[model samples]
Target: MRSWKRRGPTYCKDTWGCPRSQRKRVVFNKFGQPIGKIGKKFTNFLGTVARLGAELPIDQFDWRQVPNEKKEDAWEVVQDYYDVDEMHKSWTLSNIGTKWKDWKCYLRKTYFDPGFPCTDDRVIGDQWTGLYAHWQSSLAQKHSITNKANRSKQVMMHTNGTQSFACKRYDLEKGSGKVLSRPELFKLTHTKKNGKIVDKA
Candidate 1:
């Protein structure tokens, strides 16, 4: 034996009912009226077809053509977004505020020939030796020390391929002389015309 279920209403074939699952007792909004269902099914169908079409390997597609005047306006919009300060920071130089006359005098009196040295060949008594003695005396006066053994000294030398010279000094404890390094001596002898230090001969 089989039981038969009773059907309340047959509304599937009705054109004014639910479009997909056509029901007679259709749901409604606050206003008592039939709510149409055609728009939902149309939108769903179009979305599914678009998803399937995207899987195809289409190389080119048509885009709305932009005019030349509009393209230039778009370029200006891109340039306006750039940061001004970050772009110019690396181009700036450090300013030490040293006077030009003082630097020139220091170079002439401390390193040049005929300034302190009697002649170029006299090694024991040269411009550098006098500069070192003056530096030692300055240090002694600053520290108020009477003994020469209480001073500290430093020296840097600069050199080229063939010729070299002593160019820098401080003051040494218990020593009556100056010293120089290869790089500093090179700068005093072979500098650029613009007063920039040169690394190579």
Candidate 2:
């Protein structure tokens, strides 16, 4: 665990208008790449960073819309705990933004879309206190809803359990004594140990 101290909780100067504290202490898990519960925790931390560190609104649609400088500031906030080196700064920034986007989608689909009250501190946490209006407006937009419905209709999903494609690729490459191309990697990952292919097409 690592505790990162920040100036305070802040938000859009004219819109969300959250007060800035003198100092706020945040604890982060000194874990490997954000995945599973660790990823969710990191996502929430990114949300806090958007509201406080970047002085951005909670409803920002595109992560890329956030200024690179502000994103860098957020990256600085997390790099130490995540063990990301300065050399990988670009990837870290992109990862942080992507994680935040994934997190909002999760919150919208699981909690907000289901009519769950956002005020439940135990369930949603204090970090999302001011997200109701934002969720109702920008996040719940028509195109986004359509996209969510389309994604839910996905028929064939990965059967690789919790292991990521990158990890599986690494294992396959190590065992085969040759680097596998995308097609080969896809074929291997989709085929079961019993020789049953996951995708018929």
Candidate 3:
């Protein structure tokens, strides 16, 4: 819920020849990391491509033949050539909900915390154990409390919708008593681990 005031007229001075004044920009923040700005014109162009049901025309780009300096210019020309008004007509931004916040917070905590097990090994222990341990360690460090019951309660809430046997241990420890889908658990763990790798790599 932040707003940005335009500092000056937007203009494209680069080789693409897009009118700079017509550009619109949106900025996004995921957790604390800034995703940066995306121009309305670029988004519109992508929408146009989608509406036209056309694959972006990159067939002419032969990587081996194109010189480094000229390759950028070639891409711009290709992008501009495919830009059409029809794509702009279908473009709209919609809210996708905030279900990702807990996961994002967990990842940020895991990445920044020194106690996280994966700091030494790229392959963390079994996904559930690693994530739960990270969460438990983070809470313990942050709150300075050693009560196992309190830690288990936090883990249950944090690991909701996760179905690993480790998650069951967490649930039983917390005394909430519920089960979740194994496939869903696997998907969540894999996706988060992959994201961590991508971020570090």
lDDT of each: 0.29, 0.56, 0.34
lDDT top scorer: 2
lDDT of 1 by residue, 1-201 (tens): 898986432222233233433322222222222123432222122222221212211111111122334333332321232221333222110000111122223433455534454242312244335534544466635643543244343223233221212111221211435444545544555555577654532
List TM-scores for all candidates, in order: 0.13, 0.59, 0.18
In model 2, where do residues sit more than 4 Å from their true spots? 1-57, 67-69, 82-87, 119-130
Query: If the candidates were sorted by their lDDT against the true structure, best first, what order would they fall in?
Result: 2, 3, 1
The reply for model 3, stretches above 4 Å from the true place, is 1-18, 26-61, 75-201
Q: Residue 144 lDDT in model 1?
A: 37
What is the per-residue lDDT of model 2 for residues 153-174, given as tens digits with 9 covering 90 to 100? 9866666754656566656666
Would you list the clashing residue pairs of candidate 2? none
TM-score of 2: 0.59
- The stretch of ten residues in a row with the least summed lDDT in candidate 1 is 91-100
Query: Measured by TM-score, how close is model 3 to the native structure?
Result: 0.18
